[model samples]
Target: MIKVAGMLLLLDFQLLPPTASSEAAKLDSLFFFLVALCGTVATLIIIFILYFVVKYRRRTPDQLALSGRSYRTLELAWTLIPFAIFLFIFYWGAKLYFNLMTPPEDAIEINMVGRQWMWKVQHPEGQREINTLHVPLGRPVKLAIASQDVIHSFFVPAFRIHLDVVPGRYRTIWFKATETGTFHLFCSQYCGTQHSGMKGDVVVMEPEEYARWLNSGSEGSAASEGQKLFRQLSCNTCHTGDSTARAPFLGGLYGKQVNLQGGDTLLADDNYIRQSIVDPEARIVAGYKPIMPTFKGQVDEEQIMLLISFIRSLKEGREQIPPVSDPAGPQPSPVGDAIRQSETNANAGNQPRTNANSTDQE
Candidate 1:
């Protein structure tokens, strides 16, 4: 009994690393449960093996071995027991997996861009850091992760979370830190010669300290940078605030369902917004012509994130700045008026002339 107790104590020491997040605790509980179950089954199998070896050992060669007897009840018991245990494991694992994938709606959002050998973390307030993430303890954080070069994985052993960050698309993971400390962060995928060096730290601090740190380094919020990009990219020329503009007004578009040209509706989530920017022709919105140019190569991932932040901020009917016009020439009429007038002329059977000047104005 003493020996067995000592062995069990030593086994406890070999358990998983310290868990720092709520999800990590839950995951570790499931892991330990599986370990105990497997250990029990292995011990029973070993005991049975020893018993059969001794009981069947031949004492005399002439003493013909009793004809082997088969017990249907024993066979069925072994098979059914193992099968039921496997089913239980499957169901428990599936439930934990679903819980890990779903994030709370109120989670604080952060953007992460992984490159050849470094991680770029951007807070919603526009604070940027290299290879380090500062998050508040006891608050849920949702990471919108992407890779710039190749496939990378965001892994934190202490948090028991691992997610793939692929280029040209976004992946997300969330965790609520329960402890206040720094934990190891790693890119578990092999991308290049420097994959071994793709490691960082996640610093969890108190809410007040996190807020101060977020405001210290960055000059402006991400939404502000996005606003500048929106104008510089000439997006404002068509997506005007006026309802009669050629393109749909992007105000209040985030988190809302949008009708597509293919008679399908899609929720305007971050992924959908990203696809619309990089591949505009992929899913055209209903009632809108597929004339918008793609910004795939024109902007990088960080810039795209900034633009998304800006667009998401346009909630509750917030107005956007109008497109800038040249001061050296006569001002052109609003594009909305031109669209309405052209529609009226077409309805009245009049020859609707194309507004070349209006196009030049834009």
Candidate 2:
């Protein structure tokens, strides 16, 4: 537990899949069961009241005075029955609520900020996502949600959980989708006229698929378009090669430990990657000038993911800046590493050849 100016912020990141965990399934079942019970009870009460009214009505010729007296037994039954039912509901609801509120030891933490008509998601891996949310299926996804504007609700109906996102404070909610598929997201609170139009998909996919999606460009799997954008922006110029470039070499960077210039080491995951791209000042890579232009409003989350994908791929090998169409194609090269090595080898070979020529001339 790390101290933060006297306030304790829990760090829970979920790495395990959802099916392997039983808590989410239990809460889902309990929630529907209680809802069903409420509906059934209401139906029965309405039917019973209707039946008594019809059966106990006095006929037109009856001269007896209609007493307005209430029955003690009837009142007691009504009061006790409701009280007991409420207690039952409260206990069951509280049990589920507690489970949802308190995350498991291994639950993954996702920093989620709700802005006007959009969602800004940050992964521990320096991966950033907009509108779309991709989480490994079956893993408990605990979202630390806050609103940039008014109130919003992070809702995934399939998970049967919704969190109220309030400004000036953080609200968290967790859910593990039992099945993998694209789920609907709705802002439960009415924020603006477009509240109904503000929508996105919560894709609960297999872990492999999630990884592929993260790496993949907007156009294909395994490489994101952001990777292409990174090339277009010429980010590879300084980030790769032995050119005495200012920034960290992006090759083999994804999932690798990065030693920041400020002496801070961070895992080059989603959020870190996003911040480094947009706000390079946050965690300076030590040697590189913060000369990186801030992408702030210029780049969206999808583009950021693509850029991250490209960086992630770069970390693995000297592949092409624009990853080739074929996976078997050659990887992009470091801006200057390969060239520098080739130059050294070429110079060494030439020197020996030159000496041989001089011997012949002598």
Write one digit per residue (lDDT tens) for candidate 1, span 22-60: 899988888899889889989999999999889988888
Candidate 2, residue 175: lDDT: 72
Candidate 2 Cα outliers beyond 4 Å, as residue runs: 1-28, 65-70, 217-362
lDDT of 2: 0.61
The lDDT per prediction is 0.77, 0.61
Error of 2 at 193 (Å): 2.8
Per-residue accuracy of model 2 over 20-118 as CA lDDT, tens digit each: 224556765776787698889889999999998787776777647567987999989989998998898789889888888886645555567787788
**The CA-based lDDT of model 1 is what?**
0.77
Question: What is the TM-score of candidate 1?
Answer: 0.81
